[model samples]
Target: MADRLVPSISLKDFENRKGEITKQLLDAAETAGFLTLVDHGITVDEIEKQFALSKAFFDLPAKVKSKTPHDTKSNNGWEYKAQLRPSTGTYDQKESLWLQRGSQWPSDEDVPHFKDTTTEFLDKCAKVSNQVLSCLAIALNLPDDHFRVANDPNKPDCLTQLRLIHYPASENAVGTWRAGSHTDIGILTLLFQREGEDGLEICPGRESHSSFAMGDVFTPLPAHTGPIVVNIGDMLMAWSDDRLKSNFHRVRAKDVGKSPSRYSIAYFNQGRRDFVLQGPLKKYPPVTVEEYFNQAVQRNFARQQAATA
Candidate 1:
């Protein structure tokens, strides 16, 4: 099989040809499961600013960075390579700082404009995410704004996560990988990665098929700086009654010579924690978003308990 490119969707066309765009989006969701978003209200300069802020935050002294340790229950703040992969039995070789809207942050004593810039980008991203969700709802034959009620920006339980991740170069690059194969557990994910760093790979059409089956082709998703790579997550997959896919993906560790590191930001658009999520087809049992997230987080870090203990 040959490598493939994820389909592209124009946010600009969505309003004009909503029906057509919804059809295209549905087809892409069913087949490719991932798509590149263009003209999504965020500018290249704005993205660059966020990237610079992330670099500055990561560059802070470990002591200063550690001031905002991640709260396990709330899933906020910084976590340094703590995500353990169930498939590979090893932790990811990266550090991540998670943010929520209106959340507290370390004072700009270390990096100027870090808070303002991040908040701005996150808010813009949220607007873009809501547009995508509306398209998905239209594709699913629900009211155009059906999903919006569950992901409303003002609701306390409708929390979203903005994660800044840095994957440093490793000595044993061949033996160690950055992130092992796994599926995202949220409603949707919008990922912005630094240009020119190659490692992200996606196995399209894996969700509806058997997980253990061989011959699944893994395609390296384009890592260009311009477009945001958007993918369906488990929650949406379940809500669609296995219609939309949440494919398995991984990032291979870079060779010692390619680049010193790679940085990416992922904004996970989750549902209201208090809302009970159920598909229109009702193929699965209803589950509260909070329970689902808590379980997924626990499983991701389960094997690392002894080491930390």
Candidate 2:
């Protein structure tokens, strides 16, 4: 089989033909299960500024960074080592700050333009997410805004988690070790590469070796700087009756001297917790929120056990 590439859309073209663009997006999702977006309308300056702030935050002493610990409730604020473990059971060797779009949006009253800049970026991201959701609906042969009905505007808990992650370089790092191997538990994920270093890999599926077979393994397509890599997650896969795929991906530890640690900003487009996660449309049986939640818990537990053993 040939390597599959996702669709790429320029910013100007995306605005001009929203309908056609959405169609193309659906096509990519149905076929490749992922796509790289270009001209996403986010400016280079803004990207740089955000990265700089992330670097400054990470550079601070661990004690200072730990001031705002990760809270299970808001899921907003900072997290240190061991505070967050991957669903796969391994502890990610990085520290991160999670930001969300809500009443809890960080206050920048003292800092000049901080609030405005962050909010502007977030708003644009949300618009992009909306476009993506519309395309997902069309791909699933449902109404354009089918997913939106689940999100109640009055309750501001629709989580759009923006995670800024920084991994420190280690001298004895093994090249093939992983940050974690697991599928995301959301609708879609939008990731930005803040640094030039490459370690992220998307595994399409596991490959088996046979007597007549070569040692070929499924691997990730290398991503460029300007394009945003989009991948399907668990909720979307379930909703689509397995029409779309929830890809498994991981980050390998890089050589200490060969490359500096990696930095990335990932925006998770998630639905509100209160919303039931039934399969949309009449093609599949309906499932309740509680059922879905229990399944997720079990899946995580299994992954963790497998990882540890």
lDDT of 2 by residue, 116-219 (tens): 76667677677767777776787677887877655322247575577888877766666644466666777788887854667777655322100112122435
**Model 2: residue 129 alpha-carbon error in angstroms:** 0.9
Query: What C-alpha RMSD separates each model from the true structure?
Result: 2.9, 4.9
Error in Å for residue 195 of model 1? 1.1
Residue 151 lDDT in candidate 1: 78
- Local accuracy by lDDT, each model: 0.79, 0.65
After aligning candidate 2 to the native by TM-score, how far in Å is the CA of 252 from where it should be?
1.2
What is the model-wide C-alpha lDDT for candidate 1?
0.79
TM-score of each: 0.90, 0.82
